[model samples]
Target: MCPLFSNLFEIMIPKLDPTVIYEIVVIVFLACWFIATVLCQFRETKISWFIRYKIDLFNLIPLWTFFAPHPGKRDYHLLFRDKITETDYSEWQEMEITEERTFWSWLWNPEKRDKKILSDVVQSLVSSIPSFREKTGNLNLLMFSTPYIIVLHAVSQCKKRSQNCYRQFMLAESSGYQKETKPALILLSVFHQI
Candidate 1:
C-alpha cells in the first residue's frame, strides 16, 4: 500500500487487523443485497394482488418505483376519432418514452408522467365505448384488446384523415356508403366527444 493510504488506514482503525476490512466490505454488500431483494419481493406481491383484483388503489400507493425498475419496452399508442359529413376519421398521438433514453439525458430532461397512468386513462376511456365493451365482454378481453385497438384505430384514423380529397369525394358520391359505415360513424362520434 502507498504510505499515505497506510497512514490513513492506521488512523481510521488503529490496531485493527487488515483482514477485517475485507470481511466488513463483504458483510455490508450482502446486507444491502438482502435488503433490496426483500423490498423488491414485497413490491411484486403487492402489485400482483392489485392487478389480480383490477384495483385502481395501486395508483394511490405509488411505491412500485422504490423497489422495481420501470419496464424496458413501451408499446402503447394514444388514439382519437371523430366524424365529419357522416364519414369516420381517426388519429394517433405520439407518446413520449423517457425510460429508453440515456441516463444523463433522462436526468437533464423535465419529468414526464408515468406511462402506466396514461395506459390507465386510455383503458378507462376505451372501456366506456359501447362497441368496445360489447366486443371485449370482460376484463381479460379488455386488457388484451386495449393496446391492439388503440394502435389499429389510430392507424386507421391517420389513413382516413390523410386522404382528405378522396374522403370528401367518397362521402359526396354515395349516400349508400354512410349506411354501411354507421358503426364506425358512431364510434367516431362517441370517441370524439370524450
Candidate 2:
C-alpha cells in the first residue's frame, strides 16, 4: 500500500465518524464561502470596493477575452495604432449583432459551416487569462466597450452618461478619427453621448 494511504488509514480512520460527517461538511462549506466573500470584498486595502460596490459576479460567469481593460485604451502604443476612439468601440460592438444572429441561427439549426462551439471554447479559454497577479502587469484582456473608457481608465466610472452607447468593437472607416490624422483625439470620449 502507498505510504500516504497507510498513514491516512492509521491516523485518520479512527477519528472518522459517519454520523456527524454531514454536519461537519456543511459547516466547512459555509465557512469557506464566507471567507471567499470576505476576501473578494477586501482585496484593495484589506477591504476593497468589491464588497461595498455590490458587483454582479453572476454576469461575469464563463468569461471571455475582451473582459479586461481595453487593450487600446490602457496602452498608449496600442491606441496609437488603433486609430479609433470610444465612438469606434461603440460602433464595433454594435456591429457584433451579426455574431448574435449567427449564434441564434446555429442554436435553432446547426450547420456545417457554423462552428459555434469554436467561439464558446475560444472565449472560455481567453477569460481564464485574467488573474490577481496579471492585473498588476499590462496584459489587460479587453472587455468590449467604448474607447474613451479605456483611454480615461475610467471603467469604474462613466456609466450614467454613457450607458446608452457602449460597444465592444469599432470600424476603422466610420470612427471619424484616425491615429495618423489626430492621435490625440483617440483619448477623448467627447465626440458624442454614449
Candidate 3:
C-alpha cells in the first residue's frame, strides 16, 4: 500500500527544480516589463501623476526605444481676416478641399506627405499681423492655436454624431480667439473639420 502511494505521488507531481523555477520567474518578469513599457509609451488614456513621474524618470534609460510624446491624430487649420477686403476666411480653402487620410491609408503607405499646409498658412497669418505679435509674446503661434483646433475638432465630431450642421457652424464662428489682438489680424479659430 505504501509503495502504491509513493508511485502515485511520483507520477502525479514531477520533481521541482530550483533552476527551472528561477528561469521561469526571469521570463515572466521580462514579459511583464515589456508590456508595461509598451503601455507607458502608447496608452491613449491619461496616466496618473505617479506613473507619469516614474516614466519621466525611466526616460533616462539610454537604450529605451519606446517614446510617444504626442501620440494620435493632430489636425491644424488657419483662420484669417483681410482688413482691406473686410472679408473673413474662417476656413483655409486648401484644407477644406484636401481629404484626410484614414489610419489604414497612413499605415499602408507611410510616406512623408505635405500635411502641414494649414499650419504653414496659420504661421504666415500670425507673422503678418503686428497685433498678434503684441498679444503673444514669444509664444509660438501653434501653441496658442492648438487648443482652439482641438475644440473645433470636438465640435465637428459632435456635429457629426448628433447630425446638427447648424451647431457645427455656430461653434466655428463663436469660438473665441486665445488672445485679443488689435485690428490687424485675429488668429480667430481653427477650422479642424472640412
Candidate 4:
C-alpha cells in the first residue's frame, strides 16, 4: 500500500489485522451497495410532488400518448368524479404491464392489478371528455384533472376568470380532473388526429 493510504488506514483502523481489514472493506462495500440500491428503488417508486408537477407539465405537451389513459381496472376518476363506476377489482387481479407479455396473459398478474385500475380510470376520463363537451358546449372551462394542490395553483395562475369554472374545478380537487373539460377536448382532438 502507498504510505499515505497506509498512514490513513493506520489511523482509521489502528488495531486492525489483515483479516479484519478485509472484513471491514467488505462491510463498507456491502453498505454502499445497499444504500445505492435503496436510493435507486426510491427514485423509481417514490412519486414526489416534484414528480407530480412534472407529470402535469408533461400533460400539456400536446402529446396524445401523455393523455393515453391507463388501461387498467381502477378508475382514478372515481375518487374525484361525480359518480364512481363500480367495477370488479377481481377482473384485474392478474393484470401486468410487462413489455414482452401479451395483453391477455397480463390480465392475470396480481402485481399489476392496481396499474390496470388506474389505466382504466384514465381511459374512462378520456372517453368522457367528448360527452362533457357535447353537454356543456365549448365553454371557457378550467378543468383540473390531476389531484395535486400544486396543480390547482398552477391552473389558477394559467387560466382566466369564470368563477363557475373555479368552483367546479375545486369541487373535485382531491380525485378526478380539475380542468378536465379542456384537457378532454384536447385529448379528443389528439385522438382524432391519431
TM-score of 2: 0.23
What are the per-residue Cα lDDT tens digits for candidate 1 across 1-194? 99999999889875656678778889997886555444444445764554434543444323345424644222333334434446554333333332444577546744345545555544455545566567676333442455444544433444444344222101001122345533212122123221
Candidates 1 and 2 compared by TM-score, better number: 1
Best by TM-score: 1
Top model by lDDT, which number?
A: 1
What lDDT does model 1 reach? 0.43
Alpha-carbon RMSD, each predicted model: 15.4, 16.6, 16.3, 17.1
Q: Estimate each model's TM-score.
A: 0.29, 0.23, 0.25, 0.21
lDDT of 1 at 101: 43
Candidates sorted on lDDT, descending: 1, 3, 4, 2
Candidate 3 local lDDT, 1-194, one digit each (tens)? 69999899888866558986888899997886666555555333455333446565655322243333533132343222212222533332222413446678846743324334444444444454565466776434643555445434434543132232222222111112434422232344433333
Which segments of candidate 4 are over 4 A away from where they belong?
1-108, 139-142, 145-194
- Candidate order by decreasing TM-score: 1, 3, 2, 4
Clashing pairs in 3: none
Query: Which residue pairs collide, candidate 1?
Result: 90-157
Clashes within 3 Å, all models in order: 1, 10, 0, 23
- C-alpha local distance difference test of each model: 0.43, 0.37, 0.43, 0.38
Q: What is the Å distance of residue 144 in model 2 from its true position? A: 24
